[model samples]
Structures are given as C-alpha cells and as structure tokens.
Target chain A: MTKAKVYHDGAVSGARRAVDAVMTVLLAALCIVWIYPVFLILINSLKAETAISTTSVFELPTAASFVGLGNYIYGITKLNFLSSFCYSLIITVTSVVLILLCCSMCGWYITRVPGIFSQAMYLLCVFSMVVPFQMVMFTLSKTADSLRLNTPFNIAIIYLGFGAGLAVFMFTGFMKSVPIAVEEAAMIDGCNALQIFFRIVFPILKPTMISTAILETMWVWNDYLLPTLVLDIKKYRTIPMAIQYFRGSYGKVEMGPMMACIMITVLPIIIMYLFCQKYIIEGVIAGAVKG
Target chain B: MEKAIKKYWPVFLLPTFAAFVIGFIWPFLWGIYLSFHKFVTVSKTTFVGLDNYFSVFSDPTFVSAFWFTAKFTIVSTILINVLAFALALMLTRGLKGTNVFRTVFFLPNLIGGIVLGYIWQILLNGILTNLGLPLLALDAKYGFWGLIILMCWQQIGYMMIIYIAGLQNVPGDLIEAASIDGATSMQTLFKVKLPMVMPSVTICTFLTLTNSFKLFDQNLSLTGGEPAKASQMLALNIYDTIFSRSGAQWKGIGQAKAVIFFLLVVAIALVQLYFTRRKEVQQ
Candidate 1:
C-alpha cells in the first residue's frame, strides 16, 4: 500500500526525518500545554491551604508535603460527598433507564408509522436538539413548583422530557439501519409490537443504548442547572450542586479541598469517557451528521 | 391483526406524546406566551404586548452579551474545526501511535462542561496569578479568550472524530484518480479530499455553532460573566435575568430574549444545512 517515493533523493529522507522530528516536538509541546493545567490542579489539591495560597502552584512539596489524603478526606466530609454521590447516582441511573426505554419505544413507533405526523414528530425531535435549556428553565421550574412535583421523582420525570429528543433522534437513526424484514418475521411469529421491541429489536440496539446511557449519564450526573433549580434541598443535592454550595459556603477560597471535590466529581466522567469513547464517537456520528 | 395494530398506534404513541407535550411542547408554548407577559409565575402572567422585547433590545448588557457570544462562537468554531480537521488528516495517514494520540486528545471532550470550566479556571488562575491578574479582575477580553480556549480544547477532539470518520470514507480511488492526473499533494487535498469532507464539515460547523450559542454550564462555572458581567453570553444573560436578578418585570424580557435566541439559532442552522446539504455527494 505504500506509495512509490518521489522523495527518494539523498536529502529527501533527511528532510522528512527532520520534519517528522519537528512535528513530534511541536505536538509534544502542545500536549504539555493541554495536560499541564490538570497537573497543576492535582498538585495544588494535595498541598495545605496556606501552601496553596502562598507558594507557586508549580513549587515542589517539602516535608510538609505529604498531607496524605487529608485534603480528599476533608473534601468528602465538607462537600457532603456521600449524600451527593447517592443522589446523583439515583437520578442518573433512573433517568437513563427511563429515557432509553421511552425513547426506544417512541423511536420504534415513529419509524414504523408511515404517516406525515410521524415525519413531523421526527423533525420536532431534531429541532428540539437546538433548543437552549434556558428557554424552558423558568416556565418549567415555575410549573414544577406550582404543580408541587419538585421532588426527586418529579425531577426525574423532567429529565425524561429533556432527554427524550436526543434519545429518539439517536434511536431513530440506528433503527433505520435495522432491516425491516427482521421486524416482519418477528411479527409473523406472533410477536406483538411490545414483544418485538423488547425481545428482538431492543437487543440489537444495545450499542446505541449504551451510547445513550453514557451520554445521558454524564449529562444528568454532572448537570448543574436543572438540579440546581429543582433539587434545591440539601438532602437531595447532586454532586455538582453540592460542589457549588461548598464553594459558595467556604466564603474564602480553599483551593486545595475545592479542587479535590472537583476532581471527585470529574473522575466518573473521565472514566466513562475513556472506556466508552468509541461508542460515543459512533453514536455521535450517526446522530450528528444525519440532521 | 393489521387493523388491531392500526388502532393501537395511538395507544403506543400516547405515553411519549403526552410526556413530550407536558415536558417540551408545553414549556416552549408557555415560553412564547410568557415572552409577552409580565409576571413572576406562569399563573400571574399579564399580557404586556411587546414591551419585554423592547426592553431586551434597549438593554446595553444584552447587546454586549450578544456581540460577545457571536464573536466567541465565530472564533471557537473556526479554531475547533481547523484543529480537528488537521488532526484528522494527520491521524488518517495510517501512522503508528495515532490511535493513542487520538484517545488522549479526545479524553478532554468526555469531561462535563462545568467540571472542565472549573478545572480550567483554576489552571488559568494559576497562570494569571503570576501576571498579577486574578481571574476575577481580568477584563472581559481575558474571560472571552479563556472561554474560547476552554471550548476549543474540549470540542477539538469531538470534531476530530467526526472528521476522521469523514476522512476514512473518502474513497481511495478518488485520490488515486487525482494523483494519476498529475495532481500535487496540496492540489489533491484541496480538490479531492476537501470536497469529499464537505458533509462532515457542514455537520461539524452546525454542531459547533449551536453548542457555542447554547453554552451555559461552562459559562456559569468559568467566569460567570465576571469583571462586571462583561463576559456574559446571551444564554447566561437570560439565565441571570431570571434567577440572579429579582422582580417579575424581566421574566418576560428573559423569555423574549430566549425567543430571539431561538430564531437566530434556527435561521442560521437552516441556512447552514441548506448550504452544506447541497455539497453532499450520493456516495
């Protein structure tokens, strides 16, 4: 597969090597720039409050250096880490399952129905992707407060609505690539629509489901705005909201522990992304380029 | 059985339809209605005509935020696409270690906006602290640039993945044809490779535009319109109007701004789609 080298002259290989070296050096420099800030925060998080404030963030830690998880331990206690983690996990897991089920069903129906309405509804879902969360913030919050459904369950319901559009969009795209003959064969075997979806079609959508799960899990888990508005109670604070409150309540900035808290919240997202990145990219390409 | 299925279509669709109506449709309709009303709550809404829209236009802060957002969107979109396309091209050369490099670069995109914002804030603050300008005291220009950098870093990897997909699907025969016709490397890239990637380009551009405009969590966590709200984007401005500020007077104004924001987004997106879809080939 290698192309015949026009650059086979004596100086060509040398020049090519030089160019490659320069590109590698430049890319390495950019990588440092990209990744060093993260290192700065991680280092600062280990130091004492005074050390963080007084010394350069780049400074090496001395004998006083080994606070040895004190900052992290304290951050957990201060940020109400257990409560927030639980709350976030509950909301994220529950909402993702619900969104996946409902959006999959809805997507199935939309794709199956040969009507103008289904087409219009599909377009609506795509259009909703661009709707800013702020557009619905006030009315929805006020409506939630008025209906008195601002509890955790109600908040989950709200997430379903907010998530439905994107989920349906993804499901529909993936479903289109699914063969109709399979569905017809399942139908001929006396499979009801529900049975077909749950037993046959749904299993094929495992990858998209995972993609949706990862995407929504990250959004709902780390979501600040929606939870901030709805789950204002201390008992129900999600991790991001708790971190915000912790930051606000400290009055004076405590860089070490705050960064520690931030890292704790960020860890799950980074881990999930690292593992599911291939699926994420495929799902994004399928969902993104179509519309 | 077919008749039964036909009759039950509505039943199957009803749950999702109801939820969509209540959750998305209702709020959107109410937002449009509320934009013309004066009220703290939906129940208290009073028809105030286009007064809210009037105030939104006259507000200096809103104007500045609009311009700031537009400029930020333009710069970040360009930077993200260019960087992503370049990276995609480099990686698609079948080079060793490219997958590892792609994974490393794309890791940042997986982090949530709010977390990325706060992380970058600390890092930028560290650098700025040396220059004797805290993140807080830095001018709107600094905030603007900070956001652009953060957004570019997070988005470049995502756009790269898209461009990579686009590049992979570019038929080798097209490149071979160009080469056989005596096209130079740059000529092949511009005439053959670039044309083939137009679909990806369109999609990537639209994604960048919408994402930049609707940005909220990051804008909130990063600078939060620091240095006197000078860095406020349009979305942040609408949010602050509703929550940070008191009084029902501006609720309608916020809604009005949102409607305007919606129209702007839709119009631009439609135009972009039309332009890009025209360039897409059957293959």
Candidate 2:
C-alpha cells in the first residue's frame, strides 16, 4: 500500500480506539452509580443508629459509630427477620416449583390437544397476563381467607393461579417448537402419557423450565402487594412486607437495624444471582421475547 | 394420544385448572360484579349501577393519579428503552470487562422494588439535604423524579439484556453490506441496526408500559403519595381507595377504578404491541 493510504488507515483506527476508550470509561462510571445505593446501605448497616441518622450518609463509619454485628442481631431477634427470610424462601420455592410442574403440563396438553376447551384455556391464560393484580387483590384475599388458603405455605396455590398466565404462555410457546416426532415415537412404544412426559418430554424442557423457574422465582420472591393483601399479615410476612412493617413499627428510631435488614434481604439474592447469572440473563430474554 | 391425554386430564390439568379457577377466574368475575355494586366486605352489597363508576370519574384524586401515571409511564418507557439500547450497543462492541459491567448494572433488578425504593429514599434524602432542597417525600415533583430515577436504575439493565440479544442477532452480513456500501457508522446504526432491533423494542416497550402502570410497591415505599396524594399512581390509588378507606361506597368505587385501570393497561399494551410488531422486519 501507498504511504498516504497507510496513514489514513492509522487515523481511522485511532479514532475507533478513542471511541472505544470513551465508552469504557463512561460505562465504568455508570456501574459505580448503579451500585452506589446497595453499597450505601451496606456501609450504613455497620454504623451506629446515631451515625446513620445524624451524620451525612456519604461519610464512612468511624470507630465510634461502628456497631459490628449489633444491628444484624437486632434484626434477627426483634424484627423477625429470620422467620420472614424463611417465609420468603419457602413461598418462592413452592410457587416456582408448582408453576413449573403445572404450567408445563397444562402447556403440553393445550399444545397437543386441538379442541375448543383447550383453545379457551390457552386464551384465558393469555388474557390473565394483562389483568393487573389490583383488579383481583381485594376479593382474592377475602376468597383465600374463606377457603383457608391464606397461609404462607398454601399461598403458592394462589401464585400458581396468578403466575400461570406467563408460565403457561411461555411453556406453550416452547412446547410448540418441540418436534412432535419424539413424543409420537414414545407413544408408539406403549408408554403412557405420564411416563412419556416424565421420561422424555420433561428432560427436553429443562432449558425453558430453568427460564420459567427463574422468572417466577424473581416475581414470587420480590412480590409485595399480593402477599400483603392475601396472606394473613399478622401471621405471615414476606421480606418486603416484613421490611415495610419493620420500618413502620420502629419508625425512624431503628434506622440501623432497618439498614441491616435491607442488607440481609439483598445479600442472598445477589449471591444467588452471581452463581446463576447466565440463566437469569437468558431467562429474562426468553421471558421478554415470548412475552 | 388424544384419548390417552383426555383420560388422564385429572392428573395433567386438574390441579392447575382448579387453582386458576379459584385464584383468578372466580375473583376476576366477582371483582367485575362488585364494581357495579356497593359493598364493604363481600356479603352485604346493594346494586349501585353506574354510581360507583361515576364516583371514580368525579373523584379529583383519581383523575390526578391517572394523569400522573400516564406521564410517568411515557417518560420512563422512553428513557429506559433509549438508555438500554445505547448501553446494549456499547457493551456489544467487544469491550473488555463488559460482562462485569453488565452484572453490576443488573444487580439492582434482582432486588425487590420496595427495598429499592427505601434504599433510594435514604440516598436521595441525604443528597437533597446536603443540597438544602426538600426531601423526596415532601414534594410531588421530587417524589415523581425520585421514582423515575429508581425505575430507570432497576429496569435499564433488564431492557439492556433484551436489546443486547436483539443486537447480537442482527445478521453480520447486513452490517458488512452497509459498511461495504460506504455507509457512515451513524447511518449504519440508525438505518440498519435500529430497524433490525424492532422486536426487542416491541418487547421492552410492552414490559415497561405494563410495569409502569401496575407499579405499586415502589410507589408505596418511595412517596406513599405524600404531600396530599399528589404523586399517587393508578395502582396505589386503587389500593388506598380499597383498604385504607372506610364505608361501603369507597369499596365499590375502588373496584370500579380497578376495572377501569385494567382496561386502560390492556388497551395501551395491545396498541403498543400492534404498532411495534408491524415495524418488525421479517428475517
């Protein structure tokens, strides 16, 4: 190549490098800003109550203000944090497992069976997707209470109904993409529908199952309004409801423990997220694309 | 196969169908019925016809909340999609440590909305106090922007993931053809990349639109519609009207508002999906 052509190429590549550098710096700055809130809570949780409220939150905790594990202890003991954590865990797991099993089966049935009833069922699940929880919150709670389905353990049934829409929709979409030849062959072997599903189809659906489980787990774990309204609040409180009630009961005086509780609530989810980051990202994409 | 499945319907579908009927269908039908009647609890109800609907329309707080939620939805939806798309573009540029940045940004979305709101409340209040400004709860405008900031933080990462997926799926041949045709980078982005990612745009828009309308936990914990309820959204308004209010009339009115809210969200989501889907290019 001529010298001029080589010089032109160098300049163009230099400009591209400049743009890349600028973007890296900008994204790095934004990440810090994005994580600042969680960091702020973490540091303040270690500070004394007076420091959290009286001093500017930007300051690092001093020897005088540091309370060590005092706030965590208070949160666990006085604030019922342990019970709420367990409740959140139990509720989220049960609801997700129930949603996966039921919705996958329902999705499989509707996809394979071509009839008016199946069509209507699929349509109803799609319709339920758009119905805001507010529309059914009040009456649903009352209904749950009347039927004795208001306990934390049993509320998974309620979530199954509420969450069935998206779960069924997603599962059905994936099911349609699954080749029918496999199922046909399994059927030809004299395998029952249940056996075929458990042995062949269920294993094939592992990816979508992970997607649905992650999506439902996030929703059931973080959900506040439904549990607040439906579950007997006196007897049961999820992490979000528990935190809100904790704040209300303590008012402003217990800011330290509140921060501690917030950290406690957030840490485990973050840890889980770090472990399953791939599935979470893929699950989101799968959910959004199908949704 | 059909006969076998039909025979096993009790095992395959009964549990879900039963739970759905009890959980969603019954409550939904009852809610629609309750919207037209006056009742405090469930048992005692008097037919009120259109009176509850009329009350919802006439209530000034409900009207203001409708506007607030509308404005908030529009602003946040636009901000989130744009920023998310931009970040998606940046992260897809073969940058080093892009994964780490993506993880950092996405961390917020994993946290619950209520916790996010309270965390932001403390942070924003501190900043405002340092600047000698009003607290987030003390003014509707601050509360509005505070909620916006919180939402943008929580959602941009999620929308970015979807957009990244969309961006990655864009055919390399199309981009190569554009560059070969001497298209400027700006032209290649706007004319080539943007149009190809319309599917992602459609999904993100739908998710953001519905989420912004149905938002409650964040609204409750962030502002609680303080300063005389100026910042209340539709969901929070319906909530307060139902649980916090007394008397039979308010309950009916709340149900009416909920039905209206449901219709509004459905209409908007449908329209959005239609328009965006039309723009999606067939691959």
Candidate 3:
C-alpha cells in the first residue's frame, strides 16, 4: 500500500507539481463562482432599497448605497419577519423531533419482527418517498383542515406522516445491520420491550437518528407549498412563505428587506453547516448512497 | 426476539403508521378520486369520467408546460452530472485547499430553492441587461436557459460530493495497473475510472431527474411562466390550474394533470434506474 501510494504522490515530477499548482488555482476560481451569488445577496441585503437596480446590482455597495442593519430592522418590524422566523423554528424543531422518535421506533419494530405486516409497512414507507408532493397537495390541505392539523404545533403531526418514508427507511436500513444479541440479552434481564428499545436500541441508533433529523429538518424548514396550502397564511407563515408573500404582496418589491429576510433564513443554516460540516456531509452521503 | 417484539407492535409502529395514512395514503387515494369528479370542494361532486383528462390534453398551457419541463429535465440532468463529475475528478487530485473548495461548492445546496431563485433572478437579469439582451421573463428560451443555469449552480456541488465519494472508493491499484499497461490517461479514465463510478452516475442522475421534474418553488419565483405562461413547468401548471383559476372544472382538470405528472415522474424514474442499474458493475 505504501509503495503504491508513493508512486502516486511522491513520485510526481516537477512538471506534474506545476500542473497541480495550476489546477489548484483553477479550482479556487470555481469556488469564487459558487460563493458569488450568495455574496451578492449579502451585499444586496446591506444596500439601501432605492439604491438597488438591475444596472447597479453586480457592483459593490458604495458608501451612499450602504444601510447598516436598516433593512434587517425593517424586515423584522415592518414585514413581521420575526414571527415567521419563530414559526419556522417551531415547526422545524417539532417536526424533526417527532419524526426521529416515531420513525426510529417503527424502524426497530420492522427490523426486529419478521412478519407480513412489517414487510408491508416497510414497503409502504419506501413507496411514500417516491410520490411527489403535488399529487396530494389539495386533498392533504383539506384533510389537515378537517383534522385540525392546520395549526403550527399540530402540523408536525402532518410532517411526521410525509417525512415517515425517508426517516423510517434510513433507520431500518441502519438497524438491519445492528446485532439482535444486545436486545435479546436485555430481554433476558427482566427488561420489557419498551424499556429495551428506549435504553438499548435507541442509543445504538443515535447516528442514524441525527442524520435523519438533519435531512428532515432541511426539507421541512425550506418547504413552501405545503405550509402555504395547509396553514392559514393570515395566522402562520414559514420563512419561505413569508419571503414569497413579501415579494408578491407589495406592488413594487421591497428588495432590501426581502434580501434581508433571505439572509436571515440562510445565515443560521450556513453557520450550523460550517460548525458541523463532517456530520452534515456524512449524513448526506449516507442518505444518498444507502437509500 | 421476533415474537417478543411483535407483542409490542402498537407501541412501536402505531404512531408512524397512523400518520402515514393521514399524511400520504388517504390524500393520495382521495386526490386520484377527485380527478374523476367535478367539484369545487370534496363535499359536492359529480362523477365525470375522462372528461377532465381530455380537457387536459387540449389545454395549450398544460401541453406546452409538459414539453418545456421534459426538455428542461434532460438538459439540466446531463449538464449537472457532467459538470459535477468533472469537478469531483479535479478535486480528488491531492490538490491544496480542497476542503475549503468543497465547502464553498456545497454551500448553495443547503439553501432553499426559493432563496436560490431570488438570488439568481437579480444576478442573471442584471447580466442580461448589461449585455443588451431581453430579460429572462420576456422570452421562452431565456426562461428555459435561466432555470438550467440556476439548477446547475445549486445542484452541481451536491452531485459533486456524491461523485467524489464514489471516485475515492475506486481501487488505486486499478488505475496504476492501467498506467503500467501503457494506457493513455483518457483510456485509463474511460476504461477504469468511469465504470467504477457508474453507481454514482445512477444516483446523481436519479436525483437530478426527479428534482428537476418536481421543481415548483424556483419556477414560481423566477420568470413565473411570464410572457403569457410560455415558460411554465408541469408542477407550476398543476398549481395554477387549481388555485389561479376558480371553477369546478379547473380543479378537476388540475387534479387530472397532477395524476398524469406523478405517473410521468414514476415511469421515467423507473426506466432511468433500470437502464442505469444494468450498467452498474458490482464490486
């Protein structure tokens, strides 16, 4: 292994090293391209509303164009973006938590018990992942209203339903590889099934749970149409809904405050991602490959 | 273990199963049923077989939207995978600052589609204005290309991460063996590396295909089927059918279109997977 590795890396000639240097520069340039649009949004958020024009958009914000925290304040107070932020946080947290708990438990049942019902449940969860949201948008909205699931807290119940397919699929896939010996030993030790699951299986499933929570949180937080259809917008709005409503509701778009709201929506996620880069990336890889 | 665990089925499975029925199963079955009935609300309905489906075929906007989305899916899928694979290949070459570059590239994937749409709408239109071209919303072709560009920007890094993972798993000895056999770099890439990454190709294509087809929010924010709805996609078409218009017939037709849209996605996805899976080599 070391010989092969040395041939691939240490054996590289000076010319190859030069080529590597040039390639690194090219990759660095592409990184700038990836970041430019987000940077554009950030600078636009700081610019005065009137200063924003199609012609001057790409230019850096000038001293005259800059408005320090002005747009953020306007977005919070005037457009009531803070309430939308709170609602988004509440719904995402509750939904992700509910999905993790219920789906992980269901996955344990499906994996531990071999039976016809368990097989059917597993297949149904798998099938649900493929069905598009548009297929049931209208009917689901009506169902939510009928069931009184249109409120912020109750909507997590709705998310648990839609999110079950992915969450259960992930958990079950992870669980099948886990040995049954631990649970069997627990069962022999005068532990009932509930106690065994809560104490034994749940701890073993922590990595899968965290990854599932991240994936579901990403979806529920950014989801726009589901909330718009199910929730009464007059009462509750997610961050995406608020941004869309902010744009179309005004006769002329409030570009500055709108951009500020976008910044608020994106910053927390970026911060979380940068902090937990390893887990988030691993979660994504595990999800795509495993599924 | 199986018998003992089965005794606690209600405790373990009941909550998720119940929510699944409420959230997905019932709404899905009812939505299909609604497609056949002419009703403003679920309470009042008249059974009308095949009438709404026929109207769906005749509607100019719906027909055009289908073609537009099909074309968009193909172009974006091919571009996204190719560019992402290229980036992955470059980044895996023991380059300096690869981590920083990877983080930056993957940044946009974490942002929501709606936010992505607004960011690009401003930047793309500004570039168009500078170049003395018509706005993106004004022309059908511009709207098509604009969406393709935006999607590639957001999804390439995501697909790149997948591709990178796949590429790193390729046995290094295989590549060295190819080099020892006097194979050219291109030959080694095609014969050795490419086949090894077929699994990633299947995954990336599946993802890009479904995502582009099911896309709604970005299509809504960007262009929004402007220039008289010339650039509308299938999802946006289904949405506008029910909500943008107010009538019993339109709702029925919208439901019908949605059913068709779902089947199209499922069929295409299955076919893509079948062919791609056949090509994937087992390790």
Candidate 4:
C-alpha cells in the first residue's frame, strides 16, 4: 500500500496534519470568542434584574429564583414596547416594499433600455450611493419638513430614495445576465409590457429580488437615522430611538435590563437573518465580489 | 426608428427613469444647492456664495473631525481588508463547516450599526471596566479603536465573502503552474493569487474606505464624541454643526463641508480605482 512510505516524509506529513488540527481548533475558539457576548446577553436577559446585577453574568439562575422571561416582560413594558414595536414594524415593512418596487422597475427599465440619458441617470444614482447620507440629511430633512412628509409615508419616501441606488445597481447587474431573447419572445407572443414583466421577467428575477428584499429589509428595520430626524414626536419613536431614551434615562451603567433591551431590539433582525441567511450571504458575495 | 422608439423604449424605461429622477436625482441636486444657502428651513434657503466654504474651512472642530475621519478611513480600510482577506484564505481552504463559520462570522453584519454599536459598547466596556477605564475617555483614542474593532468585526465577514468568491474565480491553472514551478504557498499567494484577486480587493477596499468615512450611527451610539468631542467623525461633526448647535444656522458651512467631503471621497475612490484597475489582469 502507498501507506508504507518514507519515515521522514511520514513524520513531516504527520506534523503538518497536527498543525492543521491546531489551527482548526484555534479558528473555532476565535469564532466562539466572536459570538459568546451574544450568548452572554441572551442568557443574562432571562434572569431577573437583581439576579443579573448580583450574579456573574456567566452563572446560571438558581432554582429558587428561576424567573422565566421576566426580564423581557419588564423591560418591554418599561420601554413602551408596544408603540415603538408597531412603529418600527410599519416603517420597516413599508419602506422595504416601496424600495423594492421602485428599485425593480427602475432596474429593469434602465438595464433593458440603454441610452445616454439612462446612462447619465445611472451615474447620478451611483454618485448618490457614494455621497454620504449625512451630507444630504440636513437638506432632505428640511425638504421633508417643507413637504410635510414628516409622517410615516414621508419617511418611507426618503428610504426609497436612499435605498434605490444600491438596489437598482444590483437589479441592473442581474438583469444583464438575463438575455433580451426572453422579453422578445414574450413580446412576439402579444404580451403587453406589464404582462411580460409580471409573467416572464419577475419569476426569473426571484433570486435577486429575494436578495434585495432581505438586505433592504434588514437595513430599514434597524436604521436609526432617518426615523430619528423625521419622526420627532415621542409617540412615533422607533425601537432604536426608544432605546436611546432608555439609555439616557438610566444614565451610563444599567447593565441588566439595558442588555435585555438590546436583546429585544436585535431580536427581529436575528429572526429575519435566520430565515433569509443564505440569500443575504449570496447577495453580499455577488454584489461586493463583482465590484 | 420612431416606431421602434415608441414601441419598445417607454415600455421598459419610463418607470425607472421617473422614479430615479424624482426619488434620487432631484433630492441630490437640491442637497448640493442647499449647501450654498443659509436658511432656517429648506424652502427658506438664501444663497450666500463662498462664505459657508470659508467658515467650514476655518472651523477647528470640523478640521479635527476631517483629520479624524481620514485617519480612521486609512487605518480601518487597511486593517479590515487585510484581515478579511486572511480569513477568506483560511475559510476557503475546502474546510468542513465553512458555511456555518461564514454565517456565524456574518451575523454581526446583519445587525444594524446602531444595534451593533450598543451591543459592542456593553461588551467592550464590560472588559474595559477591568482595565479601570471607561469606554469614553479624554483622548477619544479608546472610542476610536473600539470603533475600528467594531467595524472590523462587523465588516470582515462581508469582505471575506467577496474575497472567497474572488479566490474561487482565480484561475486554477495559474495556481497549479506556480506550485509546479517550486513556489511556496506564500509565494503562490503573493505572486499569483493576489494579482488575480485585485478586482475583489479593489472593490472591498473602496467600500470599506467609504463606509469608514461615512459612518455615523455607530459613532453616535458608541461614543458620541464624549470627553470634549475627540472621537467625532466628519459626518457626526457636520450633523452636530447643523442640528445640535442652536442658531448655528450654518447650513452653508455644513453644505461646504459636505461638498468638500464628497469631493475628497470621490477623489480617493477614483485614485483607488485607477491604481487597482491598472493592476487588474484580464483573464
């Protein structure tokens, strides 16, 4: 058998295998280090505030004081969870849907019909992408106030504008890979433009659509900036802004419940990521790698 | 030609064009114009020529913030891309459970900047307490590094995914040829693989550099430039100047800064593109 080899070579391979094993273990350990803070927050979130403050965050709850979900319940109630929760949900879903529709239509159009104007429009959009959001925040906010879009719908419009550049870029790139033959086939079959898009093109574009949707959803869901500027009323505060209030009220070091609040805030994103993880990963790789 | 234009163009192009102009183009133009005007509100802006530019240039805090952002973009861009590329190499070695590892590493990224900022603030300050220093300090260096660390952790996996894809697309024959020619793994990487991955590196570097410069939410949540405004980035400084400082009414100044910021980012991005594109070998 080839297994019967030279001793020196065998020893060299053995040492190499050992080195690989050690590196693998080290990588695993580093990943654990990377993610353990999340676990720390999660478990500590379940404990009562007193237990959290007194006990080491690493320790388990005692049988006498195994309070189940108390921290979450109390934290939510104290933080006005219901209103902020609704606000965040409404804003995020609405913005995402609007963004997707606008981006897809624009993406399909600009890519399919190549011209000087569309090219200029596309460059303008690209420029918008690199332009720092803060640069435009003052002007946009003032404009929004002037237009009186300070309502939820207005916030959604701002998001649509902000999100369109990247989404259109992705959609256009993906659309390039889809040949003109498909659309022409539909057209020859007497399909109207709307019919052709809905029946033929959209289904083919599902993967990109899903990728765009997942990415945009995560972005709008967790976004704190636009919402902060637009929705000034205390009643309209989203979860991130609500958490800001909590931070201010509690001052610097309120570990237990504040951590619980953070866990609550991140819950939706974590949940969404769990479901759309693969598509999100694929989208990021495709988009960034190609650039 | 007229008939074809009527038949095909509008069907495919109208919706996107209308949306792009209304949603992005108009606002972007308005944003540029608003920088040169002074007003308590958007509609009320009055053009004031180069006065805003003069004020923005002279402001000490703005100047410091600009330097801070430059330093940040430089260091973090190098650190994030280098580390991410290394991790990409390790993870792409046909290892078991690479997908799971990628997912774990990427989770931080999916979490928003603000959320990640707060989470890391708690986690980091928890450690810093043992060192007898608060997370926010006088020099802002702690917050600066903390941000760099947070940015690196959150961004590495995203960049790694790109790097992995680039590594995969690298011509296998070239790698094999290098190895056959008695090249070590390091030599193969530096001499062969890196040149091929220049496109990916270029894209990743440009993105990280711009992202670092533009970061605001994380900077706000993490430090807010505490202890005498040491950690404020250019974006945050502009934000504070426009909004937080009452009667600063320095819309013109803020706009000047924005204009300058835009020019700098565009210039850097262009230079980076040129340098990287020149080195990109066509397969």
**Backbone collisions counted per model:** 0, 0, 0, 1
List TM-score (chain A only) for every prediction.
Answer: 0.89, 0.95, 0.96, 0.86
Worst 10 residues of 2 chain A by lDDT: A1-10
Give the alpha carbon lDDT tens digit for every residue of B130-168 in model 1: 887756435788888899999998999889988999988
Q: Rank the candidates by DockQ, best first.
A: 3, 2, 1, 4
Residues A1-291, candidate 2: write the lDDT tens digits. Answer: 012123336788788779889999999999889888899999899998877762379888899999998999999998788999999999998899999999999999988887998899999999999999999998899889899888888999999999999999998999998988988888999999999889988998999999999999999999999899888778888899988886556435588898999999999999999999999999999998898
TM for every model, in the order presented, reads 0.94, 0.97, 0.97, 0.91
DockQ (0 to 1) for model 1:
0.51
lDDT of 3 by residue, B76-150 (tens): 999999999999988888788989999998888888888888888988998999898998889988889999999
Give the deviation of candidate 1 from the true structure as CA RMSD.
2.3
Whole-model lDDT per candidate: 0.79, 0.90, 0.90, 0.76
iRMS of candidate 3, Å: 1.6
**DockQ comparison, 1 vs 3, better candidate:** 3
* Candidate 3 Cα misplacement greater than 4 A, ranges: A1-12
Q: For model 1, what is the C-alpha lDDT against the true structure?
A: 0.79
Minimum summed lDDT over a 10-residue window in model 4 chain A is located at A1-10
For model 4, the superposed segments whose C-alpha errors exceed 4 Å read A1-12, A47-68, A248-255, B1-19, B137-139
Q: In terms of lDDT, which candidate is stronger, 1 or 2?
A: 2
Residue pairs that clash (backbone atoms under 3 angstroms), model 2: none
Task: Compose the digit string of candidate 1's lDDT tens values, residues A1-291.
Answer: 035234245686577567666666666666677777667777777877778753277775566865757789987886567777788888888888888888888887887775787888788887778788888887777766766757666577778877788888888888888878887887898888777778888899898887787677767876888887776665577777766675556478777788787777666666776787677777667665655
